[model samples]
Target: MDTTDDARTRIDTTVAHPARRYNYWLGGKDHFAADRASGDAIAAAMPGVKLMAVENRAFMGRAVRYLAEQGIRQFLDIGTGIPAPNNTHEIAQSVDPSSRVVYVDNDPIVLTHARALLTSAPGGANAYIDGDLRDPEAILAHPDLPATLDLSRPVALLLVAVLHFIREDEHPERIIETLTAALAPGSYLVASHATWEYLPAEVIAALTRNNTDGRFQARTAARFAELLAPFDLVEPGIESVAYWHADDVPGPRPSAEEVACFGAVARIR
Candidate 1:
């Protein structure tokens, strides 16, 4: 919310971008008309998408807290959308104030709002990288990352709700491998991906057709599991984003069919 005029200058509201569209789904005010249009189309195709956004957010909080409690004090959260409450660093710093975080996103709007994303608690550090996940090397070599996190120690690599935008043809797995390979052996991988395995055939067809122009590639549950090939999955394994380590939160449970996302946390060892 610390957006400035200079930051807003980089944004192009004429075209819909992933981060802005996602923000629109999460009921954030950081999006444009183009993003709202795309988000509305998806909601019309699948009414539960808003629920997926909410649950995916919850999963990120729980996973980050779990990692911090496990002594992971560094975080590399890629695909960090617009500034939101309880973000990666906020959750981690709440558990361990010394946590360091590097947030990366290609969206111009996100880069413009760097001030909000860069705020960190005392004893913690936060930095922003204007990079894309499609190019892992550039992000890995970014100067801001090394300044904030230690590659020699454990770091949590977050890819929540980002990979689906990269087509399977783009070799998303290879991109992930490139990033994880550079981390220390004790590093962790926390991810939440969109999956259409739970929808009916007709709904899936509609959703696919609606998103073809938008370039959203929703995968099945099994294929989603393969992305974690480099790491060992934690207890309870891959499940709906809403259900992963969510027993502590008091609320009426949402079914996997409603959430429509595959979420998991894995260890590099």
Candidate 2:
């Protein structure tokens, strides 16, 4: 089928998708009733779920800006959800208008809105590919990716708030390894993952029960680090998204338990 027909066929409003549910959590208007129901069910179990989503977004912005400032001009943002403010390309191009970004996601809704993610600055470029995180090879093989980003040069791989959705059986470590192996030595890996380490036993149990679809799998800080492999972490490693270079994010940041996510930036060794 053609891209348009494929997208239309894949979009089922009756089923809850991670991208739409995440858009609902972020207060975007693109989600359907099913997405809202799933989001609400999770929020019912963990009252701070929305807060975690918001903080995770902020962490992504901070990481992109940091990488851009470090002279990185290319970004590979996997699991790109519905278009939102301060997206990876926006943040990166803001620093250097020539920045190039290629976003990959399997969501058909995201595919329909690919144009919004493609708006680049005058000198920069952006591209969107309908792809899944489980298959890193296909993402790297997409024509748009190579056309938009030179893999021989440094590139920042942004896997923000999407890793937890990749179940243990999916072999997330292998996925990361495959992606990182395709990057240059100076390239970086910026990631944030949901963690269960800080939650109370009751909250954890409730979250587990509410996760009927098995969409989430929160990991500990140590396990999250292990997934990154040989990459050397940057300073302030494995911090809560609320405090990851949040110097300008105002006073009284939320605790790690409330955020329930860990973010880190690491270099390709």
Write the residue-wise lDDT of candidate 2 on 228-264 in tens digits: 7589988898899999999889879998989899999
lDDT (C-alpha) at residue 249 in model 2: 90
lDDT of 2: 0.92
TM-score of each model, paired residue for residue:
0.95, 0.97
> Worst lDDT window (10 residues) for model 1?
1-10
lDDT of each: 0.90, 0.92
Which lDDT value does model 2 have at 208? Answer: 93
Candidate 1 has which clashing residue pairs, if any?
none
Runs of candidate 1 exceeding 4 Å displacement: 1-9
Task: Give the Cα-based TM-score of candidate 1 against the true structure.
Answer: 0.95
